[model samples]
Target: MTDRNRRFLLKARPNGMPKTSDFALVEEALPDLQPGQFLIRNHYASLDPAIRGWLDDAPSYMPPVALGDPVRASTVGVVAESKAEGFKAGDWVMGLNAIEEYSMAQAGGFSQLIDIGNVSSPTHFLSVMGAVGLTAYFGVTEILKPEAGQTMLVSGAAGAVGSLVGQLGKQAGCRVIGIAGGPAKCARLTDDYGFDAAIDYRGKSAEALSDEIGAAAPKGIDLVFENVGGIGLDATLLHLNRFARVALCGLISEYNSEHYGARNLWQLIVHSATVRGFLISEFLDRFAEGAAAMAKLVGEGRLRFDEHIEEGIDNALPAFLRLFEGSNQGKMILKLI
Candidate 1:
């Protein structure tokens, strides 16, 4: 491949919140693929809050997107050229691809092939059919162990994982309450997503938020699927029923903070509540199972998922900022030709 590759790079580590200066866009000629390698033309990229942790230099489940390296993201695209025996050109696949117009991968790096035959769009993989679905599925069933009639509250309910988690909770016969920023997102959660209740965190104080959540779950919350931590978790901790399960999915609030206060963790011990942190990578062995179950639910019209896509790789920084601003209603993706 002699084509020029357009890409985005992590120019600098962010101190608290990322700015446009943290990234730099560049163009380079693509290198020829070796035998057993394939060239991919990336079309869609997943923009996740977890990517913020990947920008730091600290050790994590995966290393930070290295300085000057194309930002790491899950992407869907078609194989333009292939030398591997199992893969042929024109196959549609999704996996860990850099945020760029084109990516070259050795055979081992590519995961399962995606069947886009009856799916709505390729971008679905970045949301319902991809890692987001797996994260929500496992987090709800395995981690939370939610029972029918139990009450479930999800922070960041408008996000990719949280939205699905809340819907699955409702499907399981639980009363679902969503916590999201702003009235618009709160309204979307209750009206559009079938949540039993939605609370606007921007308007309510932490104490008032706890009271509202408490009123929603009069019997006390059986499960809390947490995405944004810090204050939200602190407020919710005051209302946990005995033996409640809290799935720590992502700490978007604290992810970018230098230091965050947690003043209410003692309530966990008081209530015998259990909180477990989960990384989707740990459930990778069961990804196929999770994906199949989520797909079946979606195919059967038992689930509804959404994606907010921003066109062009050049807008990646601003697009990513949407996650923190609560500007996106679902899985956020970047489109690059």
Candidate 2:
């Protein structure tokens, strides 16, 4: 093992959008391993939109990232050393390993072993078998419960969570419409992910988008996988059919802003709609079911996934910002090794 560990440290609190300047890289000596402890070499770190929420000092579902902490990140790694029972050297695992070259993880903190026999790659532990896939599964099955032949719309459609949600909607026999930023993303949603229709948000304004979505779902929308708040939510609200259900996932559009102005929620009352916010953490026990279903679909060619990987850990900040800029085409990940 190396004498010094290299890791990304949270240097300062972000006021708006976080930049590379907000983080600092530091080298420190590794501490002696205690009982029931293990050391790991990180391979890939998952960059998620929810990380922005973790940077703020607010009361949320999870605690904020403390100053000088190794900027919390979910990573897949191989164990290098262990003093813990049931774990040994060369064991591949997934856990909250922080953004570091090496980390000492407590035995009980994390130990989700990767089943490479079924999955295509290790990073699937962070995408299809991780929180992203579970978020999509629960958001579609429990919240939306879309009926066959009904129409469903998804915002942030090409993203990790939204892309899976669109596929699950299709599997349920719903006509799925995806809203992404560019033609490339839109095309991938339709051609690769099996979405029924794709709307390029960058090509037209929100007002102009209303007609396109309306034409696609002429009977009005039965379900909305809301990954973006603000204007996207407003547009979906305008087309919600009576008894329409909306699963409110992450709101990427409003994450960096100081104030996210309210939209016309009265449309919900007029249309008799229901919107519910969800977090995957609340349904952790059901992860096995979600993973099994996703794996089965993938094995049958009924569902597909893509990863937009940026090489090296140094590219994390730039790659993460791509979510807001509409630059990433699929699940964005940073290869740390």
Candidate 3:
């Protein structure tokens, strides 16, 4: 427990998109485990868009990642030492820890023991079987509630949560349409994930994108799973069916920048629609329920997802930037060991 740890700390609140200079990788001695605390040697960290929002000094669901502190992230690590009541050394666990070589936390809350018997890989705790998968599961089943013969539209459809949302929408027998950038991702939406149709939003204006959505879904969108907001959301708003339901998840496009325009917020009034903004944390008690259902589908090969893993604490900044750049191949993970 006397090992020196390398931690990625927030050096400054980012202005617009983050840069390497916004974070600092510093070495420090691991503190002795105090009473009611446990320490783990982190093996992997989930690189998610929500983590980016924490870098700003703004009020949110949680406090922002304070300057000169380890940047907060969901990490899977092994218990190297424990002074806490429920945890013991040599145990595998995952939780909202930080991006570092070693993380110290108290017992309970989000940090819980991992059943290695059910885990296929440590990274799966950060990907398909983890928060990413659970986010898609609860958002679709509980919030959006896609119905048979209905049309469901998912923005950021090529990425982790969005892709899974589209697939789950299909399981509900909804006609799923995905909005992604580029032809390759659009093709993958239909070819790989079984989306009924895909729209490429790269070169299109709001009107153009809305027209494409209308064509793909002439009946109008009954359920909208929104991830990337702004233009795509505005476009989708214009195409809502009467009394459509919209699940507002993470707005990745507005995280790094201060500029975000809806232009069509009034459409909800016009269409008698319902838009619910939710956090996955809201379903904390039902995690076991969602996990079991998603696990069954995954085990049967009915659910598919990919992880874009980048190794080393030294690569944390670049790996995170991949999410904003849309260059990441799958659910983003940082491998520290």
Error of 1 at 9 (Å): 0.7
In model 2, residue pairs whose N, Cα or C atoms come closer than 3 Å (at least 3 residues apart or on different chains), thus clashing, are none
Scored by TM-score, the top model is 3
Ranking 2 against 3 by lDDT, winner: 3
Give the clashing residue pairs of candidate 3, or none: none
Worst window of 10 by summed lDDT in candidate 1: 104-113
Per-prediction TM-score: 0.97, 0.96, 0.98
Q: Estimate every model's Cα lDDT from 0 to 1.
A: 0.87, 0.85, 0.91
RMSD in angstroms between candidate 3 and the native structure over all alpha carbons:
1.0
**Which should have the higher TM-score, number 1 or number 2?**
1
Off by over 4 Å in 1: none
- Candidate 2, residues 101-201, lDDT tens digits: the string is 88888776756667666777888888877878888888889889878999999999998899999999998999999998878888889988999999987
Q: What is the lDDT of residue 58 in candidate 2?
A: 88
Name the lDDT of candidate 3.
0.91
Model 3 C-alpha lDDT per residue in residues 1-337, reported as the tens digit of each score: 5579999999988898999888899999988779999998899999999998788777889999989999999999999998998899999999999999999899766798888687578888888778999999999999998789999999999999999999999999999999998889999899999999999999799899999999999989899999999888998999999999999997898988775879899999999999999999999999889888988998999988988999999999999999988988889999999
lDDT of 2 at 68: 90
